[model samples]
Target: MTETFTYTDDLQIEVVNEGTAKFEDQKPQALIDLKSWISDEIKAGNIEGWLPYNNFESSVTWKIIPK
Candidate 1:
């Protein structure tokens, strides 16, 4: 399944599952998972100029595309 994560306020991450059209709040642990995922993607050079700390206040959307 593909998921889209939208970072909102503190401890409020909105998750949208594309396959099921389901929406829910990400668990606290998901924050760590997200950070790790972003870090990996950055290392792979998938994204540029945006870090987790720098984009917290603004709206950031990350799509987890299925392989």
Candidate 2:
């Protein structure tokens, strides 16, 4: 399952695979699409910050914090 959590005043997006949910492993296209969506949001002034991938595996998060 794809789960998204919004925190930090709704300016951040935290996505992950929990339990039996491993979307990245099963579908590479999903990851690509996800990044594209994130980029669009950032360009549209939705999310507020940017960072490098946070984990060992392909990243499943888009967290941006204003400076």
Candidate 3:
């Protein structure tokens, strides 16, 4: 399962995998289409602040769910 969490600032997104939950210091840098996610969050009014990825933590990790 993918769980997304945000701090006071919404610029950074954290996706956590409940199965493994391994934290890594580096993640594959790429562009992500978060239109739907952002829209949902905005509707709920959870968004707080905005910042560049450079200002956020560069490390993240998620686990594969077993079938």
| Most lDDT-accurate candidate | 2
List the candidate numbers ranked by TM-score, top first: 2, 1, 3
lDDT of 3: 0.37
The CA lDDT of each predicted structure is 0.43, 0.53, 0.37
Ranking by lDDT: 2, 1, 3
Identify the leading candidate in terms of TM-score: 2
lDDT of 2 by residue, 1-67 (tens): 4444433464545555433445456578865666677768778876533333425434444556432
lDDT of 3 by residue, 3-63 (tens): 4434235244545433333323223223232334444555676543232233355323322
lDDT of 2: 0.53
- Candidate 3 local lDDT, residue 64: 21
Ten residues in sequence with the least summed lDDT for candidate 3 = 58-67
Model 2 TM-score?
0.43
Which is better, 2 or 3, measured by TM-score? 2
- Separately for all candidates shown, the number of backbone clashes (residues 3 or more apart, or on different chains) is 0, 2, 0
How well does each candidate superpose onto the true structure, as a TM-score? 0.34, 0.43, 0.23
- In model 2, which regions exceed 4 Å deviation? 1-14, 17-20, 48-62, 65-67
Q: What is the C-alpha RMSD of each candidate to the true structure, in Å?
A: 12.2, 10.2, 12.2
Point out the higher-scoring one by TM-score: 1 or 3: 1
